[model samples]
Target: MVRIDLKEKEAGTGTDLDSVLAKQRAAFNAHTNPPWSERKANLQKLGKAIEEHAEEFQKAISEDFGNRAYEETTIAELLVIKGGISHALKHTKHWMRARRAPTALQYKPASNRIIPQPLGVIGIISPWNYPLQLAVMPLIGALGAGNRAMIKPSEYTPRLSDLLKRVLGTIFTEDEVYVATGGVKVASAFSALPFDHMIFTGSTSVGKIVAAAAAKNLVPCTLELGGKSPTIIDESANMDTAVARIANGKLLNAGQTCVAPDYVLMPAEKINSFSDAIIEKAESFYPTFAGNKDYTSIIADSHYARLQDLLEDAENKGARIRVAGDDDKQQLAKERRVPLTVVTETTPDMKIMQEEIFGPLLPVVASETLEDSMQYVQSHERPLALYWFGEDKSKREKVLTETISGGVSINETAWHVVQEDIPFGGVGPSGMGAYHGEHGFETFSHMKGVFTQSRFSQGKNLFPPYTDKTRKMLGLMKKIL
Candidate 1:
């Protein structure tokens, strides 16, 4: 009974989501959910399909976002997909095995175990920043946990979503996995659906709305939202390594990544050296970013406008702007690309310092003491990720223990997400719930407890009416048990 809903082609053609949900529910009710072995096989099949269509996926991503680098896309998006599949295949058997539990003495001759069961149909809403990886990663977990899934990719990256649908449709039946494509209306309707579980990856604001919608049906959610993630550089830190790593993380995808170093904290004396090194690194990497075809890209006009607004506001507030390449605003604006600009003498009141600047602008905040820097970060919203660039173990440990974030890295940036064995998620305003490896598989599953008892009877004396002896015996049994 499921059909494609193509009404109003201009609005973006979305599948009949109601029918899709109905079909999934029917499948769930009929106990047709894929077994653990079948789930593993399907995941491996999907991973193989991604590998076969790697070129097409890369091309679609580049076309959608203007200049996504092939190698970067492969490492960030495709490799993560492959890693998820590999992790699932390796751990599916173990994950599906029933876990035994200790039984109390009172329950003699009885055994107990916890069983991991599927949570029926799961809905995944992905963002455009890292569309392919974010969309497929959650699906891998749901599949590994033996659940059907429906994915709704961001409308901003329409071509990539279409390409994903075409590629995935070949490997998976609609009843097993479905990809729904459309604009905001479709996204809203999709969110409102009564899924057993949902995972949404996007801005914190939109994540709130998604959570609200999911709340209506009491659907548990895993929200991957963004916040102003910070990178702390102490005086004892390696200046060269810190600058290089920060520059690389910030400039990737033109600073579109959620975990990209939003700003840096450094001692007053080290500010000049750090800023100089950052500029040098930027030139070596981009050379001529405004005209360079090798460098990646910005999302679109509106995003560029927003970044520009942040820069203009910062500039007007007496902050010195240092451009890595050209300072010609008109030329940069015309190309819809802005050079990596570092803002110094920034205050907490500025818009750039207040909001999560999802762009190429990097603000360098100077701290007189390490305590001041830690306190500064503590005052702000807990970030999705935190990076520390110091060789001193004590200093690093202090920051790690005192400050709170979704995840943290020492001496590097943004590499923690690739580890399939570790959990990746956020806290507070950043997000809620963890997903990536086995943690992701567990998120989409309901752990049910099972117990079996022997037929032997040991309580025949309890059938007698209340008496002095019986009461004393019952009291003694209760105490011993």
Candidate 2:
């Protein structure tokens, strides 16, 4: 059985950010670079706690979001985090191994090694969407690398954040893991803390603020920010499969996913057909959106209103927008639900096209040619993810090579972010740095480079300015190496 520290933790864990960081830093000092077995044990205990308390988390997130689908919380948040824990535990030993590097000829009998050491303390700032998963996933990496962590969950998801604090308090000492909650002020304060490493997952605009704050402390950060991820449907694509995948990714959290295809690029002639297919696919998937348990709702009045403004702005600018249950705006509004909106005839001047549309608004832009689609992607800041749907091997390879994104899901969408073996991150405005699986372990680690030299080696021969022997050695190296 995994250990759950049953001692009652003190209240106000979410209030004092400075105390949390100081306590965690002290804890890290007490236990610097914990053994692989301990790290593995930590991950196991977390996984066990999660497995036992999954339903509570699901319910808390549901409450926090007004109506986030329970199944989404289960599949996207809980299950995915469980997978991360398992992966980290399994591979931590190998990840902890010091790698020996080759030495230069001049440094005969000398060797170098790269040792991965735990950063003293890590700070994680997770977004409201997929709150539990985003917060805990990075914690997995920090613990797997033997670093104490302080997580600042989003202000929007108060219930989930509180639950996370309570749940984690039961399982871990505050120093080992802490959750601090508040609105923008608390978040700003948390960002200014002198953490060893910081990870922020949210919008690019806020990421900049976090980055600036972290920079003042000279703390390195991994920014998992949002952008307009594109999904391209080629002429040779299987229309139905493409539509289904896009629908799944976009509608996962009522289109709140950072990696959801913000826009669709397809051949101009196939625009109407693709739009029709997506509307049909969305309807078939969730026959009733607003009152449906399978469908998630907008978390706040502000976000819901923002989505409305985006829709109105798009329509006013001449985009054809279709909601899931067309003509049920009244019902949708009552539930804080916005259906999958397939938008076409979109232009760059529109609000939906300019900003990262964090709702179920798909801006379908007509691409006259494959070059046009690729060029369109290039014109903007790199995306968090890029999806291409087609079987043409050469075209697929071209798209992969020509475009840049944080990740890619060829013929699919959003699923690539969960891979334990790979790094998940973004580029340019999308964000920077990556963390997942062993990559996460490394990201939170300080890879200290160590060089060892044999006492009797000739390394000291070149220590002085102008020795004949040093000249000979340098000449030989230049000629041979």
Model 2: runs farther than 4 Å from truth?
1-15
Worst 10 residues of 2 by lDDT: 1-10
- At residue 457, give the lDDT of candidate 1: 38
Clashes of each: 0, 0
TM-score of every model? Answer: 0.92, 0.96
Best by lDDT: 2
What tens-digit string does per-residue lDDT give for candidate 2 at 1-481?
A: 1122222132233236778778888888987979988888888888988888888888988987878777889889988998898888778999899999888776767889999999989999999998999999999999999999988888777777888888888889988998887666677888999999999999999999999999999999999998999998998889989999999999999999999889999877888988888888999988988788888998887889999999899899898877677647788888889988888888889999999999888889989777999999999999999999999999999999999999999999999999888889999999889999988988999999999988878766678787899899779878867
Which TM-score value belongs to model 2? 0.96
- Which 10 consecutive positions of candidate 1 have the poorest summed lDDT? 1-10
